[model samples]
Target: MTGNRFVTQALGEYTLAGLANCSAEIVKTARPVNLNLFSIKWPVTALVSIAHRISGVLLFLAMPLLLYLFELSLSSEAGFRRAGAMLASPMPRLVGWLLAVALLYHLIAGCRHLLMDMGFGETWRGGKAGARTVIAISVLGAILAGILLW
Candidate 1:
């Protein structure tokens, strides 16, 4: 076996030495590292992209709670009433509205991404416009969801 070579019984063969060398070389390169996120002025398109990811994560995290409430609502008549009452409270209503807004934003951003995949909004100008449009539509959807929920 060579100094840079390693063998794994399950994986057959692998080499970490090359990866280590490559990372070391990368570290030696002079690159500007901005650790302060707040100091950077992010573009609208970048902000929208970040928000899209955040909304997706929020939706994923809320899924279990949503499914539990749904199951409770469908379990029995009393369970249905209890679930309704629980959702009727201020905090639950606020959470539900927030989830609704996140869902709406995610859906809108997803549509924008699909459009981009289809060759639309590939340019800088187009991407910025699409991001603005997504924000506008999401805001409108949030207002509508709030009205319906409240």
Candidate 2:
């Protein structure tokens, strides 16, 4: 028999009412939509971890601005003064502080990853402890820098 005619005959037999959807065991599926409810507990450690990654990305994107500043400082003593003076502006100072913190976090995280690669933090507990150490170091460095800056 022709393929078209066979398909038509098959459809005529198992169709539900007028339409052709009579296959057994229809499956249902869904993706979890996270609605921020008050009942949900936000993890501080997770947030800090995400912020570390975001800061890394911010640092990467700010490379051009940083390079410009660096070049300006190295160009001449007058250029150094001008670049230094730019940091005196509140916005630039704030950005500089953020960049410093990002640098600290990146450095600490890199060390942690390096240790992990050396088979130090291979287990679950080891990883968590390493993360905590990174946080502590980053926080202490940031606090020290902040105190000095402010």
Candidate 3:
């Protein structure tokens, strides 16, 4: 009674003090850490994956801005010219180039999704082939964009 002043319910594993000690041990032994690439150079497939995610994020975030510009353009003629002048700027042109690339990536990835939906790229080999296709298409789109923009 002198040492054990408190007890949990009848079916319990630990008192509050016991739980605190257990948690401290767990924290010391099981601290979370990031999976840093210690010695490996980045792989092409990983780059492609990161690019895909970036393109997706860019498209999602740009959608709102693009929609707002559209709304502003429709509000009045001055609004239309303002939006037009913004697009005509060097910075906006660069952003447009980025958006175009993202759109191309999204389109190619969406086509891959459609193919998978249709049961085309199901197996590991098929998935690899589809990834190859994405790489090819993404490169092709870049070439096309370069030609168009230049």
| lDDT of the candidates, in the order given | 0.76, 0.70, 0.68
Clashes of 1: 0
- Model 2 residue runs over 4 Å out of place are 1-49
After TM-score superposition, the amount by which residue 49's alpha carbon in candidate 2 deviates from its true location, in angstroms, is: 4.5
Which ten contiguous residues of candidate 3 have the minimum total lDDT? 2-11
Q: In angstroms, what RMSD does candidate 1 have relative to the true structure?
A: 12.1
lDDT of 2 at 103: 89
Worst 10 residues of 2 by lDDT: 27-36
Alpha-carbon deviation at 67 in model 2, angstroms: 0.6
Cα deviation of 33, candidate 1, in Å: 5.2
Q: Give per-residue lDDT, candidate 3, residue 91.
A: 83
Judge candidate 1 at residue 79 and give its lDDT: 89
Please provide, for model 1 over 1-150, each residue's C-alpha lDDT reduced to its tens digit, 9 standing for 90 to 100: 111111121112222333354666674663224324454446677688789899899999999999999999999999899998986788999998999999889999899889988999877778889989999999999999888877
Clashes of each: 0, 0, 0
Residue-level error in angstroms, candidate 2, position 66: 0.3
Candidate 3 runs further than 4 Å off? 1-47
lDDT (Cα, tens digit) per residue for candidate 3, span 14-56: 2333446567778577543433343334434344556778899
lDDT of 1: 0.76
**Candidate numbers, best lDDT first, in rank order:** 1, 2, 3
